[model samples]
Target: MLYGAQYYRPPFPGRACWRRDLAHMKELGFNCVKHWAVWNWIEREPGCFDFSELDELVALSREYGLQVVINTVPEGAPYWTYEGNEEDLYRTADGQRVAYGGPANLPSGGWPGLCMDKPEFAALVAAFIEETARHFADEPAVIAIDVWNEPHLEPMYDYRSNMLCYCRHSRAAFRAWLKGKYPSLDALNRAWYRTYSSWEQVEPPPRFGTWADMLDWRRFWLDNLAGWLKLRAGAARRGAPGKVVQTHVAYSGILGNRIVGGLGNELGDEFLLAREVDWFGLSSFPKWLMGPDHAYRHLIHNEMVAEAAHGKLFYQVELQGGAGKPGLLGGEVPDAGDVKIWNWNTISAGGKGTVYWQYAPEPAGVESPGFGLTGFAGEDTPRSLAASECAGRLNLPELDAAVRVPAENAVYASRSSDLLTFASERREEMYAGSLSGVFRAAYERGIPVRFLHEDYIGELAEATVRFLYLPLPLVLSERETEHLVRFVERGGTLVSEACPGLYRPDGLLDQEGTALGRLFGLGHREIQGLPDWGMVTACCEDGTVFAGKWYRQLVNPGQDVRVLARFEDGEAAVTERLLGKGRAVWIGTYPSYYHEHGFELDGGGKRDGTRDLLTRFMSLGGYGIIEKVEVPECESSGISLAPVVRLHRLEGEYLLTVVNHLEREARVKVWFREEQAFAGGPGKCLELTVPARDGTCARWSSSRR
Candidate 1:
């Protein structure tokens, strides 16, 4: 495990003091450090390359026994590069220059928002990468090369600049992409309903206007980013022949705009960006995730990142360490306990390497009082002590050999649904909102979820995934619809939301035939999007009433379907269709979304007992479908009480970890049913508890007794 921190800028306070900082890192049990190879800082002049500072830092790092991972900060293009290449800068649909620091920083020293569409920018980035890679290629101390910090035309997640890249390059590239997809302009017109005189006139729309153009545009950027990632990663591989190359995204595209900074799903939410890298990486802010607005999204995203990394885990490149800008929940700096829990939670949830944001906050930068393991003045803070303790704990052999926790339930997440959500006025609110709700419901119930992309729905036969939670599926291809049918036919129980597969992948209505309707036994009637709080009131078969938002699609059920819930108008809102060896329960509206959104202490964020639906699924021969550790009374004690538990199997023992998500203390009991080879976990059933905002781990084997 690499206990690491980011330190790219020259050196805080002075040249010689940085060595002392490295020594402090070594004393704290940190074995690695990631240094950003900032383009602007290095190349003061466009083509004039300088490596004096970086070379010294690398050499100094080796002296301190710290392995180095160099991040090529090409995204932060120097002011000089943009001065000569203004055409490379990203422009809005209205042809306005995009310039702003993320949400908090503002126009003060904001980024020029350079797009990869320009060859000049790409050339400069490639040169920087090649030089950096070659410089540290043979240095045994250089562990890996980061391709680029966060690759995208739109600024970081919270920029909210809405300043999309619609410059001449982007527009021409879009036309070229369309030309490749659709052979003739006439064919394009037939598909897009636009009588363009020529392909040249078919410019990219200012904003997402129609589903066709929108989906296509989103796909183009994804492909474009993927292509750029491939270039960057390949360059790094060439520079350092055998070293690991990586790049990361700020937020999981699934979380969308629920938080302040999440760049919407359409831009760069792709997990499978470039496959050449050894491991995938993503950022995680502990305090940012510990809230109603983002907690569930954070949970779901970990699973998503793990799955994206070839069904493995990822490196937490930027773990939050100190008091944040708004002071991380009322200016409260994270204590030793909070630091310990967050790091432990991350590792337990399949984070390979844990690196804090920085070694020390910058003395002169926009992000002053920044998140750092040590204080800006190099004075050791409580976070440093916590990091030291956590690092010591991770060095244990038990944690090193632990296997990843198994995901029993698969959350069937659809990108097409995300695209559909992107086209709504409520896109920001609805982005991954429904999916997060389902995941949250399952999470609170102690069920681990794997975010299986809709693209891979048909390939889940290798694993014993019992429950497939399909929330808010709007568009599906003919193949994807078949895949869902087959999964259900193979005995996987499915829980789906309001509208499932109403349109094809191309955003075209499946007018020819009703593939999804026939499979699920649901006949679409009409949809009501909005009319104030004219929210649909639903009554479950168990006499439970719940309120939900989103367009309510009235569905007439087939004979094989059973109405499990209905709307206030007595229309069948939720239904269950039994097909072959499998059963699918379709809830009319997004009750889980409402449950997550309208959380209250008395309501327990339970959303009218939506978890009862999960219980019902478990009751109908669903409980034993997958192997899981039985947590007795967790359902009764509730999410607040039931510490978030994860188990990782090892050579001879089970490494079990539990986390308390709430502020107050909570207790729980775990009883691992014995398998023939493993025997019952902990030798026997044991009861234990953790403090508020903390976590605990236990290692057990059959021979332990």
Candidate 2:
């Protein structure tokens, strides 16, 4: 993985400027560059080809020793490529065009989204990719290719746009696919609540009948998009053998917004980790709307990227250009050092590389404000300079091995659960919006968390980690349940939330005996629903106080287990017991979410306290202990705070990290456990060491026999 910036030169494109930009990128210690090649520009003029600018840009990048991640511009084939076929475009329910019309009457609006179900459309896309790949294959600087920009739901007035494809071609293909699944239109109609007389009478459902119906449609849409990617990947590989093929997914799902579409767990995981692409990429501009806790967004992006890649290297392909008014939606601009902080945060959270959206600002373009590391004038601003310096320091080879700390536990999230939550009508209020609080809490506490898909249970079982945390509402498939049982039986500490065994694979309620139900010492006798905001005040058996929101488990603990915390209503919020050679801790409530909100609501909204508890829990579980750490102050305003820590490894060595989040800086005193003795080493007993400011590094040797 390499750190770099996005390079764009549209209105003002010259060889000299391209050379200068490449030189500037090199000076800034950028080893990679993300460049875009728009489709309209390529297919606009028949015989008058202009490779002068691109050729110069590629040559300059190679000369400067920078790798190139090229983004194909046909972003939804150009209007001319679609040949004015309305059926070749996304449509609304009423069959209206979902694209904007250009002055030339081309379907030039709304990101040029192509009708993937159209054979002609796919042929044009394949041709475009082949042409682009053939042209750039010989360029030594080109290391990877992004076949398309962000592809998802587009807002066009056409009713066809309301759902996904309903064009003639799409309807035909969809019917065929449905036939493969159900064998008959009558069966399909029964499942989808339709009364179609024949295959030709079938049309896309304008409105979904049930949650299951909507979920199935969502699955179909994902398959459609995945097929497009497959087509593009096949073309790119055939044309440019051995080159890395990748795609970028905007972090809307990470930000608690499902409106942008693209982040479905199963769809995204399978497509991204496919053998067709050597690498996968995710685009993020956290501070845009997330405010200072942009660190949380950075962490989530890394986790999701890591999960999507399934342990392969993933890139942060699009970091924010600068602090500006949020375009399209309202968002925040990071303070002076926020960009550097965010860049580091991304790396610390598992990003192998960082790439800014643009290297220099565009004078006149559709996304001008969103362009550039520097303004339109190309001055080396403070942020740009800081970013360059950070990149330089990060490129140090020793830092690579030194910075990575292997996690001791895996956190598994099911794609089925993620998609179920996303496609649910109540997704906005219930699931999607609430995940950030949990993820943000874990990050703020410096927990080395990795997102794992349910399918990777075998990998989780093989890990040397002492414990695994499975957060609540885990609707399990039989395979997942069996994997969990085996993992627990293998001496791995398993922690999960309540209501673990509920749903079957066919979306049916499974109330009979479940695989792990007895392991959890609970059964589905009652269901509890609470307000969006409520409290679960629990008193631990050890007399510690903890409070949280959402649901809790009413459990009948086995004789071998001990209840940790329970609500006043007698429901268990946290419980622990021995399973196999190890222990299992079940947290009934979503503790991470509660911690994020910090049990208070000021004008700025809720704060989080989940990190503190997680830190303490992991520490108690003998994972790793925090020796001396600075504790951040809780602010009256709604801004998030950072928590810094100096952790002592079991071998008596120390690992120190400064997590300077937004708003407040934390300072604390170091304390050692009775059994733990400090090993004398460089910076081990330093009175004051600033990891964030001076790039302080610490190492300790074990004194244990």
Best candidate, TM-score: 1
Please give the RMSD of candidate 2 to the true structure. Answer: 5.1
Q: Tens-digit lDDT track for model 1 on 130-172?
A: 8789888999999889886755554534334453668788788
Give the Cα lDDT of each candidate: 0.67, 0.58
lDDT of 2 by residue, 264-294 (tens): 3323434333434667667766666455555
How big is the positional error of residue 15 in model 1, measured in Å on the Cα after superposition?
1.7
Give the TM-score comparing model 1 with the true structure, all chains together: 0.90
Candidate 1: what lDDT? 0.67
Q: TM-score for every candidate vs. truth?
A: 0.90, 0.83
Q: Once model 2 is optimally superposed onto the true structure by TM-score, how far is the C-alpha of residue 267 displaced, in angstroms?
A: 7.1
Please state the error at residue 674 of candidate 2 in Å.
14
